[model samples]
Target: MKTLTLDLSGIYTAVTPQSIQAWEEKSNQYQQQLHAGTGLGNDFLGWINLPCEISEEQLSSIEEAARGLQERCDYVVSIGIGGSYLGARAVIEALTPSFEAYQTKHTAPQVIFAGHNIGEDYLSELVAFLRDKRFGLINISKSGTTTEPAIAFRILKALLEEQVGREEARERIIAVTDKARGALRTLADKEGYKTFIIPDDIGGRFSVLTPVGLLPIAVAGFDIRELVRGAREMKALVDESVPFAENPSALYAAARNSLYQAGKKIEILGNFHPRLHYIGEWWKQLYGESEGKDHKGIFNASVDFSADLHSMGQWIQEGERSIFETIVSIAEPNTTLRIESDEANLDGLNYLAGKRVDEVNKMAELGVRVAHIDGGVPNIRIVLPKLDAYYIGQLFYFFEKAVGISGYMLEVNPFNQPGVEAYKKNMFALLEKPGFEAETEAIKARLK
Candidate 1:
C-alpha cells in the first residue's frame, strides 16, 4: 500500500486520543457480538467464511446469469434502495463515460434502476419503454417487505408473466435478499426465481461484497473473483496490532474526523481512477451515515480529478475553507492502450510526439498536487498501486474498517441506518393500505 500522509498543519489535526482509544476498546468488545455465530470475526469485517458464503463462486454464477439476461433482454432493471442500488449504480456510472457511447469492447449492458425512488414519471417512463420488450429484473432487498423494491418487483413480475405467460417469467428473474429467509426469500422460493443471499451478519450498507453488491457488479460484467480476491487479501493483512497512529485505515478515519472537530465541516474525496468512482459512493455512505448525527460533523463529497478538472475543479481550487480533501489516487491504469501518433491530424496539427499516457498522467498529477498545495488546501492522497481485483478488495476492506473505527471514535453506530428507515415509514403511511389512509392524511396535514 502506498500511504500518503496529508499535511494537517494550519488545518485542525487535533484528536482526542482518549476517545480514539475508547472506540478501539469498544470495537474489540463488539467484535464477537457483531459476528456472533457466523464465526467470521471482525477481521473479515462483515463477511462470513462459510462455503455457502463463497462470494467468488456466487459472482461467477451471477455473470452467467447476466449473460443469459443480456442475450434474452433489451434492458436489465435493478430494484433496490439505499446501499443496495447506490454502490452498484455509482460503480457502473463512474466507470462508464458520461456521454452514452455507441461502441465498447463489450455489448453494452443498459441497466435501468428503479425502486430507489417511487417517482411516478420515472417508473411510468420505464414501464412505457419496456412495454412488451424482452427484459429481466434483479431485485435486491433484505426483506421482501420493503415497499419500494417490493412494489417495483410486483409490477415487473406481473409484466414478466404477461410477456413470458407465467411459465418462462419465473426463470427470467433473480432475487438477492436475506440468507435464511425473509419476505424476499419466501417470494424467491414460491415464485421459482433464482435467488442469492445478502449475508445475515452484514448490514445493508456493509453488505456490498455479499450478494447485494456482487449481483449487480457481476451483472455489469465486472470481474467478481478479482473483487473477492481483493477483499480476501485485506482480511488476511490488516490487524489491530498495526499501531493505531500509523495504521493506514485507522489513521485515515481518525484524521478526517479530527479535522471535522476543528470546524472543517466538509470532506472531499478525489479519485484519480475513474473505475473506482463507486468506491467513493461507498465512502460517502460510510462517512455520512456514521457521522451525520446530533447536529455534528463534516459532509462528504467525491470528485474525479482530471474529468472534473474543468467543472467542480474550479471551486475546489478556490473553494470555501470548509473542505479537507482525501484524494483516492491510482498509480497505474487497469489497461494501457498506447496513444498512436495522429497521422491525419483531423482535430489539430500534431504537436504530439511518441509518449506513453503514463508520462502525461504523471505530469498532470504533479500539476494538481502543486496547485492544491499552493491553495492552502488540506489534502491527503490514497495511492492505489493499480486498478485491479486485489487492490479494490484491499481498498474496500480498509475503508470498511476505517468507517467502523471512525463511527466508534464518533460514538455512532456506523453499522445501522435508523434514519433511512424514517422516511420509509412516512412513505408507507402515505401508500394506500387497509388502515393507512387516516394516518396518512394526518401526516400529510402536518406537511401542509
Candidate 2:
C-alpha cells in the first residue's frame, strides 16, 4: 500500500535542508524519550504505541458495540469535547458522503455530535429533531462532570429515556470514559450502559484510534480495520530506529520547527477538499492543545481553500510574513465529476471543459501555493495517495507523532494541556459552582 509523503521543496525559500537537519539529533532524542517513556507527560504515552497496542478483542468489541448502535438507531449522537469528539468526527466527515445529510436511509446510524458546546439553540433543535427519530447517545468523558458534555448528556439522556424507557435507553447508550472511576463510569456501572475504557494513559486529544474515535467512525459506517491498518503503517515508519531523513514525522517536525525558528509563529493547516474542514479542526486541537504551552508553541489555525481563498486568502497572501502553511493535498479524489462544455462559453471556462472538478481544484491549490510562496509564505505539502479510511488513518497518526516530536523539540510536554483550565475556572466561578467559593468571590470582585 502507498503511504503518505511530505514535500518540503516549497519550504526551502524560508528554511534550508541544513537548518532542518540541525534538529535531527534533538528530535531523535525526544523520539527516544517518547519510546522509553522518559519524557514530560509520560503517563499519557499509551498513545505513542496505541496503534500497535490495540488488541483484536478490543477491535471486535468496538465493532460489535457499533453494530448494536447501528442496528437500533437512525442517528447516534457522539458527545464529547476536544479529542473525544474531534477525531471521530474528522474521520466520519471525511469518509461520509457530502450529501448524506439529505439521504433518507443509511447503512449505519448517522453520527452527530453534542457536548462540545453549550449553545442553547443547538441543543434545543437537536432534542426537537430527535424527538421523533430513533437515536442513541455515545457519552464520552473522563469525568462525566465536564460542564459542556455533562449538560448535553443530562438533557439527551432524559430525552432518550422518555422516548424508549430507561431500560431500553441503557441498551442504546455507550459510555467511553474512565475504566474504573469518574462519574460517567459510575453511572455506566450502575445503569448498565455498555462501556469502553478511555485508557488512563491516553489523553483525550490523542485518543482517536482508541474506542473514543473508532466506535463513532465505526457507527458512521466506515472501516475501522482499514483505519487501524493505515495507522499501523505510519507507526512503524516513525519508529525511533527509522532514520530522520526517511521519516515523514521527523522531517515534518524538523521543517516546521525550522520555519518557527525563522519567525513564522502561526501555522495554518490548509486543505483544498471541503470535507477536510473538520480534519483541520481536529489538527488545530491536536497541535494547539499539545504544543500551545509555556508561551512557546506555534499558533495553530486552519483554512478551507477556494472558499477561504475569498476571505482568508487575502490576508494569507499579503498579510504579515509570520505565517507558514501546511497544505493537505490529496493526489486523487475519491469520486470524479467532469466539467462539460458550455455552448456560449459565457463564463470563459470552456478551456476547462472535459476536466474533472478535482483537476481544477488541484490547479487552484497549485496556483495558491505558487502565489503564497511568491508572497513570502512558506508551504509544506503533505500528499495523501487518496482520502480513504486507511490514508486518513495514516494522516492522523502522522500528525500525532509529528506533534509529539515537535513539542519535545520545543522543550515542552506534548501530552498534557495545562492552559485549557483558565477559562473553565472563570466560567465555573461566574456560575457559582460549588467547591469554587474563593474563585467565585474573586471573579465577582473583578466583575464589580
Provide the TM-score for each candidate, comma-separated. 0.81, 0.99
Q: What are the per-residue Cα lDDT tens digits for candidate 2 across 174-255?
A: 9999988899999999999999999999899899999999999999989999999999999998889999999999999999
Model 2 RMSD, rounded to 1 decimal: 0.9
lDDT of 1 at 273: 58
Error of 2 at 380 (Å): 0.2
User: How high is the CA lDDT of each candidate model?
Assistant: 0.68, 0.93
**Cα lDDT tens digits for candidate 1, 57-160:** 56677778877777776668889987888767765665455555455445646777889887878888888888887788898998888887888888888887
What is the RMSD of candidate 1? 4.8
lDDT minimum window of 10 residues, candidate 1: 3-12
Which numbered prediction scores highest in lDDT against the true structure? 2
Alpha-carbon deviation at 130 in model 1, angstroms: 3.3
